[model samples]
Target chain A: MDTKIKTNNTTSEKIHSSENIDEQMLERLFRQFSQEIPDDGFTDRVMKSIAAVSQEESVSQKTAFSLKAQIPLLKSLNWFTAILSVAIFLFAGGPQLVWNSVFAPIFSNVTSILPVSVFRWTFDDWLVAFFRQAHQLYSIDVLTTPLPTIYILLAVLTALAARRLALLTV
Target chain B: MPSVTDIALVLQVVTIGSQRAFATLVERHQEPVRRFLRSLTNGDEALADDLAQETFIRAWQGLRSFRGSASFRTWVMRIAYHTFLDEVRKSKPTETLDSNQRIEPNATQTDNFMLRHDVQQALDSLSEIERTCITLQLIEGQSIADIATISGLPQNTVKSHLMRGKQHLTTYLRNHGYKD
Candidate 1:
């Protein structure tokens, strides 16, 4: 290998002189430097450390997940939400069954007492009114018609309660 | 086909508590980080190994803070660079001097090994920042931006260090009649 000292008088001169050096020479030097990477169980040591740390983190995560899974309030609240949702569906459809089984004859009899304008109403008007009243039965109307409204409110409260319980546990 | 993003996803999973993912990270990055630290510390294999371990530990500790703004490799390398610096700070001051004191590999060694050792000693003579720049740029083959991120130096500063390091190495090789 050749050994000869190159000199420079100024800072920029030194920088510029490096540019003049052959590209192949620089590439060779870089290749030589690259070859110096260590190979003696280095990765094993790093992997071992990483394994230790990751094991600790995994343990902590499992503990947190299990702790969240154990909260009684959250468990009860989830059940409450499911049951209340079913109750809401039954309440909304239950009135239709009542109308068909018991109230239809009574509704026909009450036509005489209803206003004469209602009696003169067209088929479309009667159909629209029936739908409108059914909507009223299904609607949550706490300030207006309290029964269905209370059911709706109960379902919403149950959902909110479950969510809050879950949050607390997590 | 695992792209860089796939590797990054593995790292992210590792950060969130996956041992297998962490192992993958170690396997992928160990060589480059070892090479970079070895070059920076002037081929102290034992120290390089220790620093490499410390780097992974530090990376694991700081994994949650990684924001994915940079490539996973760059981020891990930055952690390794900082860990090496922290180790330098904590160790006895004499270690730095010892590293700078050059030694021939072996008298009976082959010519290639001696030449490699000579180049390494010439590298050792560089200032710490210059050594870091040269190691990252030449040995690690990091881009300028990545070197700046790893070294925590400004881009211009990194460039200056690379230029100065090359000039110093060139002068050293010439003095030893190793210049082509």
Candidate 2:
């Protein structure tokens, strides 16, 4: 290749000391540089890589498809679990066991922490006390003062709407 | 074969994952692809071939996305250009042609080694975009629209690059004792 280039260069130099710079000359020079690159197993290597890539893609696709296909099965299993739990709760004295093992302990812990008089009050008494506290804090019967209640309700709704809008914007 | 169109080959590959069809496409376009990359890499044939291989592989994987609005060769060359750009971004090599590797193809003889050398050196004198535009326009015979598509440059920008790049090459050649 070197010898050939040297011979060509010698011949071209002998023919013309310097070729005229023209559009044709520029194209010719570019063509000389942009010769066809011989494919010395380039296609083979590319094909091999493509084959490996395809295999990897297919494997991942198959795994993804399988997972997608299992969605219904997983959903069905969820329903089955719900039904089984319901059945066990109904047929196996589940409520009593739960009350004894869970509610009783939790209630005991709560009662142990609070005053005994707090739990002694009826549901009506608790409700009355809550209303009395609200009336005391606001200096009016909130139920009787519908204007304040409505304004407060609107303010709460507006605040909630503003919070929701802020969240969406963020 | 000459009878089989690129679209037909591409369809076969897309529909059935035909390696044979893709292989034909690769072989058919590898020369221009490699040549384009070689110019971009300043005649580093090994790097050019590696980039070419990657371009073909990407073309194979992305065959489905090819809408055939452009010719398959153009699409592959676009891939090759992007692949070259990605390498450039990763490497962050010298900005000027003067700082880059010298142009030397491991192939057939040229009529003037100094002219070829001067041509590459002149190309190196331009900015990367200008060099790309010049190489695509002059060497690869790509049109302004096609060059824009390949390089993701605006048509006007490509035009300016070609203009500036050509002016630089003309000046360099003139300075190096080439007349007219």
Best by lDDT: 2
Question: Local error of candidate 2 at B157, Å?
Answer: 2.0
Instruction: Tell me the deviation in Å of residue B43 in model 2.
Output: 1.0
The docking category that best describes candidate 1 is acceptable
Record all residue pairs in model 2 with backbone atoms less than 3 Å apart, i.e. clashing.
B97-B124
Give lDDT tens digits, candidate 2, residues A4-65: 99989976764452333256656766777666668888889999999999999999999999
Candidate 1 lDDT over A83-142, as tens digits, reads 576466646665456555676556556776874566454433554565567668986334
The lDDT per prediction is: 0.71, 0.75
Off by over 4 Å in 1: A1-23, A36-41, A54-170, B1-8, B11-16, B100-103
DockQ of 1: 0.25
CAPRI class of candidate 2: incorrect
**Which is the leading candidate under DockQ?**
1
